[model samples]
Target: MGRARCWRHRSPRRWKQFHEGCVPCQAVGVASHDGYKRGDDTVMVDGGVGDSDESGLRSIDLATLSGVLRVCDVELLLLDGNGPRAAFASRVHEEALFCSISCGFHCRGRFMLPPDWAMLGYLHATDETLSWCHGVPLTPGMALTVMPEGISEFTLSPGTHMTLMLVPVARVQRKLTELSLRSTPPAGQALSLFNLASETTPLAQHYQQLHVQLGQGASLQPEETEKLLHEHVQALLGAGAADRPGCSRARRTHYLIAQRAENFMRLNLRRNIYMNEICDAAGVSERGLRYAFEDLFGTSPNRYLSMLRLCAACRSLSMADSSRRSVKAIALSCGLWDLSRFADNYRKVFGELPRDTLMRAPAQIGQPA
Candidate 1:
């Protein structure tokens, strides 16, 4: 039996400290003695954390294997010795890595990895073979990875004990492309250039040099980091995750006008501004502003102004310097005279009592690009 402890670290300091020492693993243990069949439609494990962070790590004896699984997305699993070992399936077009950071028994003498990805195994052990259904050339290393366009599969010897870190394709690409050129080759390609015997390759050396130049001890420069963020956003967009369906041209035009109007509203949110004044501020006719705003944001200009005021009020409530401001004061300053309406709208949109959510939510919130 393997002992398992599950903990959730929420505080930035605590999470960093915990991650520094943790080793991740993923396993599909054998259900029958022969060691060649799926265990069950639903496998069970002893140690898994609940959603809440306050539960902390509860030390327990774990005789099974279970955690999170994604049939089509990436998952990070932490496996120890006493878990099931079965041929588990990975999601389609998903790349995975099982890095052997520690433990000797889990090592494999040699194995060919698939094209889109690779997995890490120890270099000394014998008797296990890993494979993928797809066509990908495998490489042996302590830091094995699968490319988004490749495969990930491996086998291990009996009584093998190892900890694995599953690296997703997106994660690796982001990490690599962050510091390299936009058109850098995939890791599998770059790694293949290395002479395994010597652990030296032009690509490896170049990558290491770039990593060091970006900051050996500190994080990357702001511009470099922003470039990486833009890449990630582009990747997400490529994945078709950013598109908003059912947005008609009229709707889009209306939205653009509303955005401009909202900008004007924010500039004058603190002052007494009339509807005509807002129309003048937006440089559009009162009827046009109303029609444009209605088409775009699905709200009246008057109602939008009210919502903006409430948004400002909520911001004030959540502000660190809000200790001196009352909710009523904020509402009145934002041109709203009704506290009940403000409270109601606040609760509906944010899903919490205004007071309770004020300090708990993030102070600097904005729309994602």
Candidate 2:
């Protein structure tokens, strides 16, 4: 991995003014609007720079892929012990936000979309049968959805490349009204997955090209952005009308069971949690729980739970105050009590000991001596 560097253009007043008038910036809580130019064929940004020369994409390597976007609440757990090494980049347009992500390892997570905004995802590449959303397999030509005010679960295989666009619900609805199309369904409806090959293939291809151009440091004019947004909304609604497949009953059951168990583990990470407790919380027998986990996550319950604890410990250590916090405390808090074993496992998963991560944390400001 190349060294990580962050550059800040400290014009707070200018940024504030820009944020006030830019809906996308406000929606995604962008701190600054500084632009990046292609340097040495790598996409460099104001805050972080991507080091990969092959892709020439500006991406930030994140420890935990949470809070990467202010509009979405994303909690991802790496299924494999390998470091997440998530490559993330985004551009906030006047009426939409576009993002591209490529993960280096298998992972699963639940994401809650911002209220009043709809997220459209296109899988640029993925391993066969390894990418899924809410128990439905994802393919290259399918349109992914997490409707406004909706929460969904997803899993990504190693080396998965995805493109995402987030547009406000009101804007899409207005476009539908103008085009004499149906408005969006009421909130809380299950998200729809539809193939985009027939009528909407050109739109999908166009969107992918636009994303590539933007990632390569091309700028979009105001009218051009507006037209792109209109076309995207139209494509989304058209896909909805085409043949779509709903999540099967068996898959939905397994997903819910796994989701409940995972939620229980996350909420009670402060102490040791047993399999029986997890099964009870999920309202399933031990055998049923194991089947559900294996079906959804391709792992046993015990292993997945262990991975969760380790990831939680990593996040805590990465964000903890080094002056006041210790690896032992964070490990115990995440239910890893054996200090020696915890250190070994943490190193194996994160490529560093707990103390090393803590040492790298930014020091707290305004401390009293």
Who wins the TM-score comparison?
2
* Per-residue lDDT of model 2, residues 1-369, tens digit only: 011122122143533333344322211112235433222111223333223435332332233256444355466777876665555556656656667666667888766665567776667777746778778777776666566544566788877877776667677667757765567632224475767764257767766775565455465455544676566556656655444656678878988898789879989988889999999999999999998888778889999988888877877776778778888899899889899998998777776678987776544433211
Please write out the lDDT profile of model 1 over residues 183-238, one tens digit for every residue.
33333232211112222532233223332331111122334323333433333223
Cα deviation in Å at residue 55, candidate 2?
6.7
* The candidate that achieves the highest lDDT relative to the unseen native structure: 2
TM-score of 2: 0.79
Question: Candidate 1 local accuracy as lDDT?
Answer: 0.35
* Range of the 10 consecutive residues with the lowest summed lDDT in candidate 2: 1-10
Supply the global lDDT for candidate 2: 0.64
